[model samples]
Target: MTLTGVTVQGRLNLSQQHLAHGLLFRDCHFDDGVDLRGAVCEELIQFVGCELNDLHADNIIARKGFSVVDCQLRRVSFASAQITEDLRLSKSRLSHEVDHVALHGPNMVIEKSLRLDETWITGEVRIPFSHVGQDLDLRSAHLDNGAGLALDATSVIVGGQLRGDDGFTARGEIRLCWGRMSSISFRAAELHKPGGVALRADSIHVSLGCYLDQGLTASGTVRLVGAQIDGELACTASTFTSASGAAIEAERLVAKDVYLDRGFRADGVVRLVGAQLARQLTCTGGHFENPAGDALDLTGITCTGSVYLNQDPQHEQCFHAHGRVQMCGASIGESLVCSSGLFEFPGGVALDADGLNAVGDVRLNQGFRAVGRVRLSRATIGRQLDCGASSFVSTENPALDLTGLVGHGDVLLTSGFRAAGQVRMRDADVSRDVDLSTAHLEGTGTKVFDAFGLRVGGTFTFQLAQPPKAEVDVRFADVRRLNDSPSSWPTRQTSMEGLTYQSVSNIPCSGRIEILQGTKAFSLQPYRQLGKVYREASKTKEEREVLIAGLRDYRNRGKLKWPQRMWNLFLEHTVGYGYRLWRPFVIALALVVLNFPIYHTAEHHNLMESVGAKESQEHHNVKHCPTDFPCFNPLAYSIQLFIPVSNLHEVDKWVPDATRGWWSTFLLGWTWLMIIIGWLLAAALGAGLSQAVRRQ
Candidate 1:
């Protein structure tokens, strides 16, 4: 049937006509095109499928049905096809250059699936306020248009993406339940219906921009896994409040610039795993509440610009970044965490752990704090293993563990480690002990190992197997050092290998004090205050005696004076007092002679009296006492007495006794002669004296 230029316009009823014809039904006035719809048509009805070509019949009603199922429509015309029943055109192949088809019906049940896949619809497709009685399944459909795709269904269900880039806008529910989309743009959209619908488009490559409005909810999960974007994606003011919850998750969402400025929230989780964002990612104020899982995880993400995740007081993370993550925030939790990522001014990092803190341990292995410095001001670790083992190298004076650390367990600084800085343990509160053995230190600067004011349970040991040869000021309080040795410490020589107890003041306490072997110079003020001062050289007995003597001398003098050499003699020794043999004897003789007076008296009496008194007494005539004392001689006395005066007492009693001895008689005769001579001599002497007085 090749009917050309034949205008049969009003309700041409040719049901089930098998024909191969060029039916030019152009500009014809028909309520519907040749109603061979339910007929078994074999050949193609060759006519451009267009209505309103003639524009005459305004109400050509084909209220039963219209079907061109599996038909090849070459050219046809029912331009303004008005119908009261359904119109079905499933699996039809129609040519281009067809327009102005207004199929007016309430329920246009196009129940079979449409195959617009790979078909390019250059113009617009609008299906508003119409009810597809069954589900409109357009799975894997492709739309290539310059403008967009619009569907304003109040409530509809599809198995796939309501997708277009000119921007999708929905008022009621645009429910693509458990479906996917390549891209979606809700620019200036008014999407508000709530069966709690979702738009899951994981691995969707979207271009330009995407904007989400408020009152738009989601229930099922959403994913943009491995999707790339080259525009600014904004979710500024949206509320995701669902019971089952939705997650806007992206495993590797590569984007240029992403912004969530102050009004974006998540009821579930937001996973940004291994995302390579090449711009700034900001999230200033939002509440993330996922008690079971992590609240916000951005692990292995590399951001080129500044990233911010600061929660306001009203909104917070219950679990907080509770997974293995790394984020360069302008303020980490509160302050800025700037390492290799871009950052601005200096601010402190605050880690609050009241709601959902990590109860497990943390291992700061190599590359842990490798980029920049970390400051832990008031942190308490339940159990932490931070062995600073040469992983950190200080370009300047790095502030490693400043403030103080409080631990219930151990903190090890093991071998092959070097801290070319001061380890300030000032005011640290620890429960167990601390060990610093086989460590190395050097340089002339003041290095401190301060553990003062610590309330510890056990002792602290610094007895290293191989310690460094350095000078350090260790100030420990109520902390004991246990060492025992006999040699001298703080000495010049190194062989004094033992322990010592040196008190700055003599304050009574327990435990010993130890200085290492190579300590060059130190002070033991008021040397007597030390418990024991030892030297390796043994002392002799003489030196001990000299030392005792000097001590005694000092004690006697009440105190030791300056110029210590006065007491230094107590340190030397000698054998004897330096003397010869007979000298002692001579001294003994002199002492005896000066001691007693009896011998001198006896000798004097024997020599003088024996030579004078005894001999004179034995002679019995008072013979020669000495010229010192005069004695009387009887015989000579008589002779001289008579010679002095002849009239010896006037007469003589010049008579001699008759019974006298011979000597006595002779003495009497001599006395008579001497009496006569004495009288004559007396007369001469008296005459001489008288002549001399006259001459005078």
Candidate 2:
């Protein structure tokens, strides 16, 4: 039935009425209310450009569809109603300025869809506890509740997508808090709520995804706290500017992935603290500027994939944060790459991620610049911390202080890496090597690299940069190998007083001397340290060699007195630095030649009896001295005095004569000197030979 320009007086009471045919109204008016309570409409029920004061359709059943295109309504109700087909309100206007809710549908179930295209609502358009089978699309809809929420669909369930996209504007809050849907998209939608939240979809369970991307703008806080999204919760190309509070507060949000990239700008704080994301939290080409406070606070977040603040492949696809970007205690499955970008936190630290645990590499390489300090102290990175070609400038204190930071792989601090202040990595454990080769470091206060107590499994390369004058203080570092040479060991004054390394093999002897000399004192610690490495490496010969060499260098240094030099020279020539087997023989022979004349005078008196000559002679039984003894040989007598262990001559037959007191005294003194040096030199040679053979 098609009715045109018709009026129904008193109420068009269609209660309990069963309609068999479809009804269409044109320019029609109902006096009180179009009561479709308990009524059953079999076919389509459309009202084209009709005016209704009140629409009471409680428990009304419609088989086909219901549409009110270009119509005006004062109030509407569809409580417990079931629509078998689509429920559309295209180009319509709904207003209940005097009432609380404009179009209330608490328990209405639509089998197909509920579309409000180009419709205008002046009051609350609520549909709580409702179910939509297909979609609830309100594209190009305008809702304005002065100081109230424009749309409140709390606890509603949608089988298909729920979209308010394409120029959908809501003056007040558009809340669908705790709703379950397949997906929710608000593309190019503008939400403005003064002194209140713009969009509050807290605890919304989305099966597919939830996208507020593509030019969606909000003036107030857009919160999706505690929302669980199976697919990505993306907000690309969106502009959120809330000066008073957080632009997007997504605390405890659980999502497969979260993306706010590609021209996404948030003027206020974006609080993603304590959120658990299964994949990446990418924010490439996004500008979050809250200069007075933190722009992005992601404390205690656990991400299975990488948290990419720098995952964009294109140029200038950077995530800019003028304020602080703190991620305290964050755990990432992969790397936290911020390579080739400029993140400037002018007065304070730009990125402060303490206690960060990552499974992959943490790369801040390739032209990365930070005006302020970057502190990643106590972080455990599974792979390398590659900060090559990066510049951090802070004059007052350490610019890049990674104190107690452990890297399982190699830490590349080389290739033109520069830090104006100290790079303090005290007590950090590097499972691999730490290469500071060709790195330019300048310390403000005491040292440039304060790597005290750092441990490295591989060689630590400290190859200085060109025109090098960087002073490093590696006080007690334990490294397997040190890739440093003698000439380039100390470009500036480096302190390696207690710096530990695995034995001192493969380094030049002069380099080892230079390192020991760095400690300016005769402390045996450095010598012991070098010897320990050699000992553990089964280089017993080298260990003894280094020990004796260290002793010689200490005693023979230019600062020592003449007596010390004499003692050192004696030890060197006589013992051959305690490792030469033939040195003692040469020394003993030289001593015997030197002392030949001292004992030659002893043959003149009773202390001068020749070999087989008797001390007392008295005519056979009354022996007489052998008159024509072979000439008293001084070389034989000298050999007798020098070789204490060998009976080389019959010098014992001659006794020291007290008659010539000075000559006898000198002979005894020579004997004592021979005795002392003989035992010492013999022991040193024996030790050297034994060690050499054992090592072989």
Q: lDDT winner among the candidates?
A: 2
Residue 567, model 1: lDDT of 30
True-structure lDDT of candidate 2: 0.79
Error of 1 at 144 (Å): 24
Q: TM-score of predicted model 2?
A: 0.78
Query: What lDDT does each candidate get?
Result: 0.36, 0.79
Can you write out model 1's per-residue Cα lDDT over 343-446, one digit (the tens) per residue? 11112121211111112232333222221222332334345424433232233223134335555554444443344433445455545554443433221134
Error of 2 at 195 (Å): 5.2
Among these predictions, the greatest TM-score belongs to: 2
- Per-candidate Cα RMSD to the true structure, in Å, reads 31.4, 5.6
lDDT of 2 at 449: 73
Give Cα distance to truth, residue 490, candidate 2, Å. Answer: 5.0
lDDT of 2 by residue, 1-696 (tens): 999999888888888899999999898988886888888999998998888888888888999988888988887788888999988888888877822688888888999998888999888888888899999988999988876888889998999999889899888888889899999998999888856789999999999999899999988889999999999998998998886889999999999899888789898889888899998988877788888888888888889998777636765676677777888899999988777656667768877888999999888888777767788899999999998988887765678888999889989987899888778888989999888878877655666777888889998887757433455667788898878645434444565657888644477654676667664335566677887787888877767777777777677544778876775676667665556667878877888888676655454444543335555643221123456443446677566654667764445544444455776677666666776777777766766666557645
lDDT of 1: 0.36
